[model samples]
Target chain A: MPQTHTFEMGMTCGSCANAARRVLEKMGEGITIDSIDVPTKRIVVTTEKSAEEVKTQLEKTGKAVSGVRITHIESH
Target chain B: LHQGKVSVEGMTCMSCVNHIQDTIGAKEGILNCTVSLQEKTATVIFDGSLWNGESVAEAIDDMGFESKLIS
Candidate 1:
């Protein structure tokens, strides 16, 4: 089952968003980015991976990831 | 030490420039990293034995931006 997680990140522009998207894409699978909103500094992704795992990957973009919120979870 | 110049793409603003500077600057062998958003370029000073222009460009590329060694 996949879980939808929303993360608060330090993204200022589209390039920052793109960086985040790329990092997640490089995760190789089981992760789908729903949206990256710079204004809200939020990134929403649905993935089978754990939040900690996803958070670690996001940190590679060199942006600060303040926290993660589990917005939706599929019923197993 | 060696100086390298790299052309970078996909940077939209100052934050992108700062991100590049901070990220690359913290890497081993990178003595200095200066990014110019207007010029779409980054000039790096690194240990010659550990890093070169091509490697710096590759590092930038790995950060999800399009980059190439200019000199």
Candidate 2:
């Protein structure tokens, strides 16, 4: 099953968003960045990993991750 | 040893501060790194012979935080 997770991060500019994207991309395979809304500071990612696990990884980027929500789950 | 300060952007909590401190502190030449969430800055003490402020700023940037050398 693949899950969609939404995280609220503290990103002040485009560079911050780009850095977050790079961090997630470097976290091995099976994780895809769905969208990053800079204004809202929300990032949505699709992956097999759980929301908690994803949150832990996201935190490594040095951005303040305020919240993580699992919005959707699909069986494959 | 040399002491320097860098301004950091986009930090909203202590975790962010801790992350920055840990990331920069882990570097070989870094002796101490203190990140302030309230000030959005980092004070680092390191071996000047082994590293420079630019590399420290780059490390913070690579970790997804914007950093600029203040001193």
Candidate 3:
């Protein structure tokens, strides 16, 4: 089952957001980025990967990650 | 210790610079890291036995930026 993970990131500019997007994109397949809003410092993604795994990857971007929440889930 | 220059792109603010410095500086064998947003480069002093220009550049590239070994 694919889960949507919402992450709190400390991004200061568009480039930071872009970097975050790229980091998540490189985490192999089965991951879709819903949004990476710099102003709100939020990143939303739907992926089959675990939240811990995704968080670990995001941290590699050298950004502070405040938290993660499972926003949505699909039942099928 | 050895010094290497890496050209990094996609950094727009001081936060980016500081993040690069803080992250890489804390890594093992990295003596220091100075990132210049204006110049779009990062100069790293690291243990030559543990790191090289290619590895340092690869580290920056892994951070979601376009990086190349300058020297």
Candidate 4:
């Protein structure tokens, strides 16, 4: 199943959005970032990876990462 | 080694990101700073021996914005 998870990344400014995008882009297969709200520092990512793994990769950017919510799931 | 992440609020455009990048980039102990208008978040890498969160937040506040650490 493909699922979208939201994470509140404690980002400071716009460049942080770029960095977060880069981290998502750099992650291994099975996941794709759908969209992100720069103003809110919230991101929605879709992935085949577990929620924990997704959060871990998102936090890898050195941003404060937390589970916001997960939805829009589809089975493969 | 110390790392910090902060949430920047009241930024409505890309210029806001540039403003923050420049401000944090100039801090004494900061080795790197990245800002995201898309997410309103900034991750900072600094020499902890030289600076801390309050000062960093102050720097952001001085820029005419609001900042708060997440962790």
Which candidate gets the maximum DockQ versus the true structure? 3
Can you write out model 1's per-residue Cα lDDT over A3-70, one digit (the tens) per residue? 89999999889998888888888899799999999999999999989999989888887788977889
Candidate 1 chain A — worst ten consecutive residues by lDDT sum? A67-76
Model 2: lDDT of residue A29: 96
**What's model 3's lDDT at B44?**
99
Clashing pairs in 1: none
Model 4 docking category:
incorrect
Q: Distance from true position, residue A44, model 1, in Å? A: 0.7
Candidate 3 residue spans exceeding 4 A from truth: none
Q: Estimate each model's TM-score.
A: 0.87, 0.58, 0.92, 0.49
Error of 4 at A57 (Å): 1.3
Query: Model 4, B26-69: lDDT tens per residue?
Result: 76889888888777888888888987876676666544456788
Give the interface RMSD values of the models in order.
Answer: 1.1, 5.3, 1.0, 9.4
Local accuracy of candidate 1 as per-residue lDDT tens digits, B4-36: 999989999898998999999999999999999
By summed lDDT, the worst window of 10 consecutive residues in model 2 chain A runs over: A67-76
Question: Model 4, A1-76: lDDT tens per residue?
Answer: 7878888987766656766676677666777888888788899888877778777766655457885687976555
True contacts kept of each: 0.61, 0.39, 0.81, 0.00
Query: How much of the true contact map at the interface does candidate 1 reproduce, as a fraction?
Result: 0.61
What lDDT does candidate 2 reach at residue B8? 86
What order do candidates take by lDDT, descending?
A: 3, 1, 2, 4
Error of 1 at B37 (Å): 1.4
Instruction: Work out the iRMS of candidate 3.
Output: 1.0
Measured by TM-score, the strongest candidate is 3
Regions of model 4 farther than 4 Å from truth: A72-76, B1-71
lDDT of all predictions, in order shown? 0.90, 0.81, 0.91, 0.73
